[model samples]
Target: MSTAEDREELLADVGDRIRAERHARGWTQAQLGTRCGLSAKVVAHVENGQTSLPLYYLAELCCGLGVTMSALLSDAWVMPTRQREERALTPRQAHILRVAASTGLPLSQVAARVGTTRQVVAARLSESYRLLGVSHLPQDERRAAAARIAEERGLFDAIESYAA
Candidate 1:
């Protein structure tokens, strides 16, 4: 976002954008939460950018907010710098993450579609945590749950794949 700022500002700017879009649609945080299947508190956090959005959820939120994915990619946003270095993951881990991000499937749906269980998805995300150099993330706290993240951020721009 606007130059001459720190990473926190960048995160807040992204949050503000999400809030702006929500207001534009005349949707309350709760309403948007319902759309995203997240609690309002989570939406508040993402709008604040206090957490690094999992790339998969970021794409979903972009679609749900009626914004392009590129909207979230400007300098306005930054992944937490301490983790997720360039050389952290194996090729397989990276590919799986990419697939999750691009697929627009919520964790459970993603698992189901692949004929697996949510535990499998959780394992993948935990692997992602390691790959990203983060600590192990509990299932609920993991940042990749599409529906949960969308609801929390009032993300109207998620891919809307369920309707298809």
Candidate 2:
């Protein structure tokens, strides 16, 4: 194939992988776009292979989809089955955990964004750490540990609709 054809084929394959991930999470394009700070139109264009996206946007999509850049690009990657424990976290807990883990925001800021007090945010985070079985770690390491576990289990994938 010509270089142009090869590039188009690659884009199409990547787009298919993206769409599969999104579908596995049961998220609409708009919802994924919201998580990634892009518009649904942009997501649609990417999924349809109608346009090439910048690496930055692609990275954002991976984050939003809770997949690694390498996973998204790899032909050998497959969606892993989620365990029951992965869904143990309530939507609220998942949202709070997600924001806390991903944003690098202070507790106060996180609380404000989640519409709760700092104390509540801390409490919820503690609860999350326990649920994720990371409470045994030092307090400082709990959040990062929980985040890593959550991401691995696809807990950050489909954020259920909740008032936040």
Highest lDDT scorer: 2
Q: How many residue pairs clash in each candidate?
A: 14, 0
lDDT of 2 by residue, 1-164 (tens): 99999999988888888888888877899999999999999999999888986898899999999999998887679865533344467778888998898887999999999999999999889898988899999877888899998888777665756642
Tens digits of lDDT, candidate 1, 1-164: 54645667766777777777777666777877777667777777878887666666556566666677675566554343222223344433443444565576687886765556778776765676654544455654445553243334343233234223
Deviation in Å, model 2, residue 69 alpha carbon: 0.4
TM-score of 1: 0.38
| CA error at residue 25 for candidate 2, angstroms | 0.5
lDDT of 2: 0.85
Q: Can you tell me which runs of candidate 2 are displaced by over 4 Å?
A: 79-164
Candidate-wise lDDT, in order = 0.59, 0.85
TM-score of each: 0.38, 0.49
CA displacement after TM-score superposition, residue 32 of candidate 1 (Å): 1.5
